[model samples]
Target chain A: MYICLMYSKEIVKGTLKPIVLKLLKEHGRMYGYEITQNVKALTEGKIQITEGALYPLLHKLQAEGVLQTESEKMGKRVRKYYKLSQSGEAVADDLISEMLDFMQTLKSVLNPDYGQA
Target chain B: MYICLMYSKEIVKGTLKPIVLKLLKEHGRMYGYEITQNVKALTEGKIQITEGALYPLLHKLQAEGVLQTESEKMGKRVRKYYKLSQSGEAVADDLISEMLDFMQTLKSVLNPDYGQA
Candidate 1:
């Protein structure tokens, strides 16, 4: 099961930061589980953002000042929600643009019909 | 100059293997310099594959049995050209498919009009 996911994992790892930022931008704020579930649902179970990969990225974004977190008590447990900071919003936009450009380049490369090579 | 390329480098680093494989699949055999130039030309100088990044990946692919190399003397210098092996061809196909799927997922995520949240 896990072995089958190697390719997806590699692709996701590269785009994870932008994906998280884009989600945060759209939703305003999202907790870890919500983020993971949203991604799973959006990708139709083809891509799963595991806790192991998600937490460190969240932490890294927080460290980089691209994300801010708010913790709210949900009964006995605390739910930490993440949202993009001002700089994060700018970063998200830049990331999306960069990703789009990259996809375009890749599309040209992948589709020889484009005759780019 | 180098700083302007940070985003592009990050994106390219993630997709380099597939890009290289695709290029090899199309061209049959290519030397390191030729591969680098091809990528630079294809991306319109937006992405540059530095020697530092390209060599290790090529070696890794060869070690994984996904690439085979042939050395020929071009004047006084020996030029190494790489091509996909049998397993390499299969891997290249899988990688291209995976990359395409990834781009689709990214397109949906990046496009707010998609309402994919």
Candidate 2:
């Protein structure tokens, strides 16, 4: 089995929102760059959250009231941090549960003996 | 945690291709309705593959040369069965491996202690 370190863009794209929400929930607040770096470090470079996918998702979450942003002055640049809103906290919980269930379904589909006794 | 019996359509949509490919690889060939019923039965009704999503995927796979269709006549109806082509066998292996890796990534994201000893 050839298990590559890098994942296909489509697979990463589908899971991006829940991944972002979960990361923010765990760490409280994170900027865009930090989220990307954290994901890369945690996945050991198996997954890379690209700017094209991350920024738009953050903006969409903000527009949907699931995330709120705060800006801080860092030397000569402004760093924007994202945190889950009250409703977003609820959404994060739901997304985590949903993803977990989805993973189980994937397991059963891939491995016939996954849930078999 | 409300783990509903039905998964969100979006999650199912993202995973449909690999699921279909794997099923075809495992069972040799299957028709549209049979595929849906097998998934429902295997997942214990947790996931449902809808026609709206399944047909277009089958057609796309056929057009892409990954799947070949055979029409068999049974009484008053002609049932179309799908089987993986030669290239599709290789693709199926790749997809299964990719899905497994992707599930591992999801595990690490959803559970921080996943890869920790």
For model 2, residues A1-117, the per-residue Cα lDDT tens digits are: 557878887666588888889899999999999999999998889889989989999999999999999999999999999999999999999988898878877888887775232
The digit string of per-residue lDDT tens for model 1 on A16-116 reads: 77788888999999999999999888777767888998899999999999999999999999999999999999989888778776777678887668524
Clash totals in order: 0, 0
lDDT of 1 by residue, B1-117 (tens): 122343455666578888899999999999999999998887677778889889999999999999999999999999999999998999998878888767766788777575243
List the candidates' TM-scores in order: 0.89, 0.93
Top candidate by TM-score: 2
* Highest DockQ against the true fold, candidate: 2
Q: What is the lDDT of residue A6 in candidate 2?
A: 89
Summarize candidate 2's per-residue lDDT along B1-117 as a digit string, tens digits. 557878887666578888899899999999999999999998889889889989999999999999999999999999999999999999888988888778877788788775232
Model 2 CAPRI quality: medium
lDDT for residue B14 in candidate 1, whole number 0-100: 78
Off-target runs (Cα >4 Å) in candidate 2 are A115-117, B115-117
User: Scored by CA lDDT, what does every candidate get?
Assistant: 0.82, 0.87
